[model samples]
Target: MGWLDRLLGRRRPRPIPPPLWQQTVARLPFLQWLPAADLARLQSLSEAFLAAKQFSGAAGLEVDDAMGVHIAAQGCLPILNLGLEWYDDWVEIIVYPDEFVVPRQEMDPDGVVHEYDEVAAGQAWDGGPLILSWQDSQMAGDGYNVVIHEFAHKLDMINGAPDGLPPLHPGMDREAWVAALDGAYDDFLARVERAEARGEEALEQLPIDPYGAEHPGEFFAVVSESFFEQPQVVAAEYPALYAQLALFYRQDPLARAQAAGSSRSR
Candidate 1:
């Protein structure tokens, strides 16, 4: 708790009534698309997340109720099947107004020291910090969600360094999760290589992020965007992938987003 937090009382925010909270949720695409009764439950879940978590803005970013609501909504989406307790292991959220540059040091394959840095939109280190860029955050849509990506990493890291596996709940089969994600990951890898071979676009409306092609851990995190932001695309092109995510997140976003998309198309 910081001096400002203690002074202003933001380590905790009192619960808004269910009706009012649902109205707050109605502003979001993911939330609003849920069935009305489910949306109400989501409101209760988000309220718990908001009350229990501490949010702080870094690098000249000012935290506020609206921002809290936004992050809380997205963060809670993944664990709706579980609870806010899914996030109980981590304690802080660090937000920046835009991208942040992090210095880097590495030894190349040649054993020569290399140093470089690049501005990143967001990053989530296991059991450490969840970092975000408000610019990309504010623009989250169409299955492109930085918050979901990083938080998914946090889930993946629950056991250790993100290896595309989050701690499984009772009765959930670990091998099944692994097999499903591995299949999708292998398919994405082949697509990337094929595109590279033919000099074609490698990431034209990919169901998962191109960056996910880097590693299984990254694939889990990036595909988490589809788990929340782009359920329809994933459901349409990768229903099994959608099914695996539906089991993990414990939410039926395809049903909701499909309904929303159908309404829009109609």
Candidate 2:
């Protein structure tokens, strides 16, 4: 057994408290939109996640049961259909009270190296601990989910370097995945450039995060945030990409939202 398994006192996970599970689900509407069976599965997966990982609070922030469960709930959504084993390679999650700055150094084409601090809400290191800003993690609505965004990066890193493509499941086409993400990435990059030229209004009007234009990997993570929180927007703006994501995730969130809406209307 692994250290985590020993720490938890068993190989299996203990259940999350009923009230905490309900409260957590209520806070995340995308999770609440799930069918009862799926939601239960997610809860189970989250319990396993909590058992397998260790969470630490940085900047003097205290990590509590509620905070842990909340983060676990959101983080486990992407792997609800896939298993917790996808995340087994990493064991630590570090949380900050708010945005944290990381020093960065980059070399230009001319070989000039520059150093600066970059403020980030969340970060997933390749084969290392995932980091998050609790303040940003609370901003889960409107396609700005830091928890899901970072978890998606964790998924992307599973194969090797994150380049907008992770290891596809059996029978999934690599060329098709490339085509879908590449086509959308190119178009989105152009749109962001155009919007930047116009002003803040155009940038704010973007259906998805303009930061996605930073790189193909960032595009995958950003659109993944949209895929869960704002599925309809993804479905409408990039149907082909949405289809690919659904195939990969094995969950059709847009369809779930539509069905939930219809049920509520009845």
- TM per model? 0.86, 0.96
Q: How many backbone clashes does every candidate have?
A: 2, 0
Winning candidate number (TM-score): 2
Q: Determine the backbone clash count of candidate 1.
A: 2
Alpha-carbon lDDT, every model: 0.76, 0.91
Q: For residues 1-266, write the lDDT of model 2, one tens digit per residue.
A: 43333435555788888998899988888887899999999988888888888888999987787888899999999999899999988999999999999999999999999999999999999999999999999989779999999999999999998898988999999999999999999999999999999999999999999999999999999999999999999999999999999999999999899999999999
Indicate which candidate wins on lDDT: 2
Q: Provide the lowest-lDDT 10-residue window in model 2.
A: 1-10
What are the per-residue Cα lDDT tens digits for candidate 1 across 1-266?
Answer: 53334423554545655554555565556777877777666667777777666677897788766676677777777887787777877777888999999888889899998889978988886677788888888767666788888889888888888989888777778888888889888988988777667654656645567788899999888888877877777777667777878877878877877787788798
